[model samples]
Target: MVDLQEQAWAALLYVVLMLVQQWIHWIPGDLG
Candidate 1:
């Protein structure tokens, strides 16, 4: 059960990081 919980958290973090990266990339495009 603990392992499963850790996996879930890791997945969530990965998704959040992906979104943040995309947002960061978009900012430069918007500025230009």
Candidate 2:
């Protein structure tokens, strides 16, 4: 259903944000 799709999208967004944060942390002096 639409609800499931929405949930999946939200989860994906969360994962992407986490990855970006991790990448920023890996780089020195990024200060993200």
The runs of at least 3 residues in candidate 2 whose Cα sits more than 4 Å from the true structure, single-residue gaps closed, are 30-32
Across residues 1-32, which tens digit of lDDT does each residue of candidate 2 receive? 59999999999999999999898889888553
Candidate number of the best TM-score: 2
Clashes of each: 0, 0
- Pairs that clash in candidate 2: none
Worst 10 residues of 2 by lDDT: 23-32
> Candidate 1 residues 1-32, lDDT tens each?
59999999999999999999898888876575
**TM-score to native of every candidate shown:** 0.76, 0.78
Give me the overall lDDT of model 1.
Answer: 0.91
Model 1 clash pairs? none
